[model samples]
Target chain A: MLKILRKEIKAFLKDRRAVMLTFLMPTILITVFALAFGSGGGDDVHKIALLVCDQDKSEITKSTINDIDSVKMIEVIPCAYDTAIDLIKKGKRTSVLIFRKGFSDSVKNLHPLPLDFKYDAARVQETGILQSILPKALFSGTVGKLITKEYFGEKLNMLDSATRYKVFAALAFGGALSDNNGKDISPEKIMRVNSTSIIAAQVGNIGLVQAVAGTAVMMLLFSLTGMGGGLLDEKEQGTLKRLLYSPVHPSQILLGKMAASIIVAIFQLSIMFIFASLVFHLHIADKILPLTILIFATAVACSGFGVFLATLARSRSQLQGMSTLIILSMSVIGGSMVPIFLMPQWMQNVSVVSINYWSIQGFYDILWRQLPIGPLFLTKVGILLAIGITLTLIAFRFFRKNVMALE
Target chain B: MIEVKNIQKSYGEIKAVKGISFSIHTGECYGLLGPNGAGKSTTINMLSTLFPPDTGEITINGLNVKTSIEEIKKILGVVPQEIALYSNFTAWENMMFWGGLHSINKTDLTKKAEELLQLVGLSDRKDEKIKGYSGGMKRRINLACALLHTPKILLLDEPTVGVDPQSRNMIFELIEQLNKDGLTIIYTTHYMEEAERLCDRIGIIDSGVILAQGTLDELKRHSEIKDVIVVECSQTPDEAYLISKLNLNVKVTDHTVYIESNDSKKDLTRCVIGCSEAGYEIHHIDIQKANLENVFLKLTGKQLRD
Candidate 1:
């Protein structure tokens, strides 16, 4: 058994093109995912150009523009109404906010303001963000202007001494009320409350990790299919018969080939994981034990499927056709090419039968969902091991029945 | 030693081997000679323990081929008709791999591989990939791989087909040397000359049945066809008149006349006189003594290659 394994490994390593392809394919996949998912860091703040067409040149409108510009997420650009409309039509600006003439009086009288908003329909996400933020900005500016006018004189601006005194008085009143209520309020309490409310979300490049794991599993299967061609090649070359002429049993030959493919798959997945961690800063090493077990089980299952494919095919061309049809379909349906959530519900339910589905889900559990090492993780591992063992037995039975009978 | 008794195999409705039986002594080169599709490979396959015979028994060294295949495989080397080495591996690597399969230790396998490579005159090219080697070189390595374990019995099925003359002679010499060293060999080929030169006994098979089996001289003596006479005439001869005048079995094709005769000298003289009396001029006359080809023709009424 060891001799056969050693020979198989030597033959695999000698094929330079195959070795290079195993690593090159995953690298390309990681790069494409990084580019598609916006660097995978999850911290990318989208900047949309917002054109403000202030028809009412009141102090309230100016204050509204300042408030909108204070948000780092949206860039505010002041333009004429006609120019803003032209820019929106030309698709240069995603959204335009218009302030009407009676906007300041409406706020002072506590009436609804006539605000007109125009957005480019093509930029749906940007338009949505702008629409959500515009209402809050307008209301805050209107209410602040009303408060300033009521507390201070109409001639006093927002930054005047009287307005500042009012703000100080309000803060002092709030503090005294808190003390009278027997509840001590301080800066530290506020800071502590703010910090406690901020949850520690799942860290690391989730998109990059998913991409690496998905592509790694899919490519691992592809590589196994290619490696499985060795079986047919040996039969054609008569080497399989020669091997049988030795003291080794036929099962040992099949085991040797499967062992080689499993090793290759494991090696491929490890390289992809390491590359993702080093280049994209993914947190693959956080749960190293579970991750390693998942990778091993995935490799075993895929390698078994590869052997099954090889035994089912009668020729090299047949193996090629079957592998293309099966691997691609599984990859597509199992969320390697597209996310499972994007797939139809029926298709997602059907994807449970695919090996890629279990592998990708297992990886997501560890790297993205950050599920603790528990039954969820063990369940994935169990399914993969079951798949590997079951498929391998089928392959062995078929091989013994069909291939071993060849003269 | 190997023994086969009434081995028969069939594929669905087609019978491939029909109750064939043979045996090889401890140190004899036995040849199974036949045309294509003659079940020679099937018989070799059965003896090699590749597959069990449908309704017969085979044993090697007193071990049943069906129940004792593992023990049988340890003592048999099969060099198939096809070149079976991994093309991507060097010749040395191929030898090592095949040798390792028999559980040969690394040091001994390496040493034996070197010795075999030297014997096949491929020692200088052992490190070259099999794909880069010529057809003859590949054939030589194929033979070398089978001999790695030094099995007691070697089953070679058309091992020299498509090989160049140099390699063919080299293979013949190698087989002869191995046989001289007490290796029992079962060589199958359609080439009569190879069988005549190498085999201690030849089994003439056709259409999945053994027509005859014996030494070359014994087969010749047993056959009625002692010699074949061919006469080239200047003009087409009348077939009816020639047969009437000579009162002998004669077949005329175009301007040539063919006759299978037990007495070459007497028949040639009679043919010359008979043709002269019939006003036919003889351009040339040739005579061939009885050999394996003629013996096969006499027994089966078909050429060995047919």
Candidate 2:
């Protein structure tokens, strides 16, 4: 076994790419993702400026301005139709509302409606807000028309008292709203908050961040299984046999191979964590040490699992195939690809046994939420450590049973 | 220093090495000679303690392979047919690590690895990756890796099989020198010439059985023919048919022909008479004794190529 292990280490040294894949590549990716894509605080909200053009100077047009700015949620600026259109086309403003000529006169006369509003069809958000406020603005315009027709009934053209009474009612309300300028009350408003629970702003969804980072880290660790191929390559060359001709048992070979893989995994995880903290602004809070320990244990177990896989595999290609199936399954079930909590309830039930789930979950608890590390968290850590140890033992035993023929 | 009595190994229904027995005395270069697929490797693998034979009682320097694999491993060096050295590593690095496997102390390992590298005529290329080395250079490094621990017995399985003549000669010389230094060597090869030149005692094994085992001279003495007659001819010549027409005791190849018999003079006189009647051209003939190929043919009644 010692013979096989030495040969495996030498083989790994021969493949510089394997070493890089094992350690450096992960470090580079983690750092790049964390630093380049990292943004702290809540995600940036979309900003839009709404511009209004009143080509017609009328009470109906003025009420439209009031309706647009009534919510005070968006900034509304009054400008010429051409200026507003150019600003919107240039993206200086996201939307422009234009009220054409004869809008107020046509509404007051109560003949065929002559009001027209033009807006950018491409501005989805602005268009939606504008659509919601259209009814309020039109109602306000109608009230202005009713007032003018009723107060000036004898001075103008009105035939029935029923219509006269209706005009009086409209004038009574419109007179108050008109003198107050274009500031009118809107019947519609938007509300955008729904949360069953809320955490502090400093954390900034730490659990989700950890889940994504941890998944990447664990999947990258699977490449260490290439060390098994190193073993098979040596055996083919007869270097393996030369090693086995020594006074060493096969267990020693497994131990050495596992050692190299674990070291690589450790380096990989540390790189990700450091990059996450320094570049991505991932908060470790007071649980940095515990998270580091958790990552270390995960690496150890996974590397041992890699060696065991190498032992069972007949060839390098076979080992790769097996490693893919095994590592991916663990990651998927463990919440490396998807957070275990987000998975279906049945899948979550399955994740309790997954190595990735435990490793990723532990990291999230330690780094993101900054919750206390009491006995419950301690038990989860214990389970992870136990799993790592068990895999090592089984893998070592497998090497002992089969490595005799390596020579 | 190696002995086997009734060793048998099988893979499922296929019998790889069937009830074979042989021995290699201390300081003796023993050869296991056979054609391809004759189970020479199966026999050697068992002797190396790589895996135990299914039915066997074997001893290496008084240590049984089945019961004392650890002891057997300590006293033997193995060079497999394939070049096992890592091309990515320097020749010296390969040797050092292999030596380390035997628990050789770090200080001793460095000195020993350097010596083996130098011996293989690769002292200058010791630090270069074996990947760039020629086939012969890699073979030399392979031998170097095996010798790192300086095992008393060397089990080399066709170490010079695919090398050029120069490299093959170098390997043979190295093996001879190692034997001179009191190393017991068990060399296996399909090349009969290698066995003839390198082995002190040769075992002709075919079909998992030893057909003959003795010194070269002793085995040659068993051949009835003392001389071979040569009849050089063109590759397209109908020599076999012409010889059969004459009813002469003769065998013809594209390059030469052999007329083997105790009465060479009488046979030649009859051959001239028969050839004259057939009107076939007569080529000069000189008789000579049989070599290993002929001896194999005489014993098996089948060509070695066949």
- Per-prediction CA RMSD (Å): 15.1, 17.1
Residue A339 displacement in candidate 2 (angstroms): 1.2
Docking class of 2: acceptable
lDDT of each: 0.78, 0.65
Model 1 steric clash pairs: none
Model 2, C-alpha of A369: deviation from truth (Å): 3.0
- Per-residue alpha-carbon lDDT of candidate 2 for residues A1-407, written as tens digits (9 for 90 to 100): 99999999999989865776677656654543332223212352222345677778777667656765664444468888778766544323445655557656645554433333444333333555544444344344454435345334454343244343333323322222222221232101110101111112233454446455556556654766776557777666666666665676766766777778778888887777677677776766566678767767777767766776776776676676567656666665665765443333345566667677667756654554343566545666788777767877887666555444542
Fraction of native contacts (fnat) of each candidate: 0.91, 0.77
The segments of candidate 1 whose C-alpha lies over 4 angstroms from its true place after superposition are A1-204, B229-287
Point to the candidate with the largest TM-score. 1
Looking at model 1, residue A202 earns an lDDT score of 48
Interface RMSD of 2: 2.6
Off by over 4 Å in 2: A1-202, A371-374, A396-407, B221-289, B299-306
Error of 1 at A265 (Å): 0.7
Residue range A291-373, candidate 1, lDDT tens digits: 88998999899999998898888777778766876787788767687655444334556778889989987887677656667
True contacts kept of 1: 0.91
TM-score of 1: 0.68
